[model samples]
Target: MIRYIKNIFLGIYCLLQGMYISMLNMIRPKVTEKYPENRGRKEMMERFRGLLTMPHNEQNEHKCTACGICMINCPNGTIQVISRKEPDEATGKEKRVLDRHLYDLGSCTFCALCTIACPQDAIAWSPVFEHTVFTRNKLVKQLNREGSKLEVKTGKS
Candidate 1:
């Protein structure tokens, strides 16, 4: 009879302990965020990786020399580099120039493998994260702007 009474008190103690923990958690502040609303730039974290982007400078020029290093390192074949040789007007010599840089965001896992493997630093992650699209064709994008050419980076500052 005494052992049975002890077990009942033990069970009640356990139940009260669980209820105390629940009450503590219920009184704490909520941490849920309201997404899809760009309230402010302060809401974005510093290390948040979004879309892979190729930055073209103000002159509409890029650093990619069509080396195909990014395409080779991509795990899902997301990057495609197209190039053509054109005679340089200044030197009368043939130079390989980038015709297109096809980036398929649909197949891309955003592992940043292509950007990390690029020798010319041609690719990077952009902070803009609103990538909702209706069609798959819209996901496949040409990184380089139309008429934009590769700029030769001189060692001289």
Candidate 2:
């Protein structure tokens, strides 16, 4: 009977201890974000790896020549460079131009191999991680912007 009373007190003491700790934690400053509601607009890290992209200059020009170097270097076949013979700025004759540069981010390993293989420095990593979508087709993006032309190197200054 004495042991029973002591056990009851011990159990109550432990319950109170747990509740006290929980209460203290509950009143403390929040340790986690509220997620979607409180997430930062630009939350990507400096070195964060994301979908590969082709950067256009202020004048909206890219350096991709459709050399297929990146495509050849990609181990997973994630890159496909489409090329066509198009008229240059000065010449009427046909010249190789990049028609489309497709990037399958879903299959990409983000190994940076394609960027390293690009001699023209056409492709690079973008910090935009909000590219998530419902369908797989949305993940496969064409790096070249629509209606945008490549930057043709004409002459030496």
What is the C-alpha local distance difference test score of each model? 0.86, 0.87
For 87-140, candidate 1 gives per-residue lDDT tens digits of: 998899998999999998889888887888888888888766777799999999
The Cα error of candidate 1 at residue 5, in Å, is 8.7
Best by TM-score: 1
Model 2, 27: alpha-carbon shift in Å? 16
**Model 2 agreement with the true structure over 19-128: per-residue lDDT tens digits:** 99999999999866566886565476677787799999877799898989999999999999998998765768888888899999889988999998899899888787
Q: Which stretches of candidate 2 lie above 4 Å from their native place?
A: 1-38, 154-157
Q: Residue 136 deviation, candidate 2, in Å?
A: 1.3
